[model samples]
Target: MAAAKSGGITAYSVKTKTKNVPMVDPVIDVKSGRYIATGKDADGNKMAAIMSKATAESHIEAGNAKKGSGWSK
Candidate 1:
């Protein structure tokens, strides 16, 4: 595993109904052709958010995360 980036990606959390919650140890993935970022919230609960391909790629490029299986930066 790579070192996590500081102040990691922030996205809406459906579980807590919060906005701009920082995600820890985020990993980018592709699901049915859409880019998705999955990680844990401050409470340790799993959270995932759909993001643009560019956003995912940027994260991967910045060492924030590695490209998931079947995906590339």
Candidate 2:
């Protein structure tokens, strides 16, 4: 499968079986390490989860969504 990107960032707005079960962290960076599903809007709608290039490609291969593909300024 081919991965899609926005603004040169490959991110996935994955949804869990239930809203409660799937939660993106309200914060993105944690301890200088990448955190999974850590973006949300003021309305609490989850934003895309960033993954690393390696992780993103791996998930693309496995057909699973892995976190880590965002670059920080």
Candidate 3:
């Protein structure tokens, strides 16, 4: 697997109330195999967290996010 270095561009999935909501989040790359995201949660309130790459991929698999750059939605 590819290792994400610090300062890389990574997106984290923000869970929604309804099923399969397509959305994107801007996250800060953490050198320790995690991402820091700042966005509104399902309740539409401010939220942030350090998430893993697997968690991010889960979001994509769950239809919450489109494929990463260079691929189609």
Candidate 4:
């Protein structure tokens, strides 16, 4: 998995599931130290943005996404 990039900053997006259904769009903003989510769905509600990460073991972890993999530091 690749780190999400916005304006040259690295970040990670993780999705939480409930009963095999997506519940929220959890995003970790690296440069700003902010964890944001679009919140749960409500009646007649629409999400502005949706981002998610894979759940496989081979999938990139949130920590790795934030740190990147091409450098040693």
Question: Which candidate has the highest TM-score of all?
Answer: 1
TM-score of each: 0.78, 0.28, 0.35, 0.19
The reply for model 1, stretches above 4 Å from the true place, is 1-7
Write candidate 4's Cα lDDT for 13-61 as tens digits: 2332222222233333322332323323333232222223232112235
As a whole number from 0 to 100, the lDDT of residue 45 in candidate 2 is: 57
Per residue, candidate 3 scores C-alpha lDDT tens digits across 1-73 of: 1222232223233444332222235333344545444444345544444556675565445544434333223
Candidate 2: tens digits of C-alpha lDDT, residues 5-71: 2212233334432322233233333234644435453346565554454654454354444233353
Q: Superposing every Cα of model 3 onto the true structure, what RMSD results?
A: 11.1
In the predicted model 2, the residue pairs found to clash are 24-37, 25-37, 25-38, 50-69, 51-68, 51-69, 52-68, 52-69
> Which regions of candidate 4 are displaced past 4 Å?
1-31, 44-73
Best by lDDT: 1
**Cα deviation of 66, candidate 2, in Å:** 11
Residue 61's lDDT in candidate 1: 86
- Residue 42 displacement in candidate 2 (angstroms): 18
State the displacement of the C-alpha of residue 38, model 4, in Å, after optimal TM-score superposition.
1.3
RMSD of 2: 9.4
Q: What's the ranking of the predictions by lDDT, best on top?
A: 1, 3, 2, 4
Query: How much lDDT does candidate 3 score?
Result: 0.41
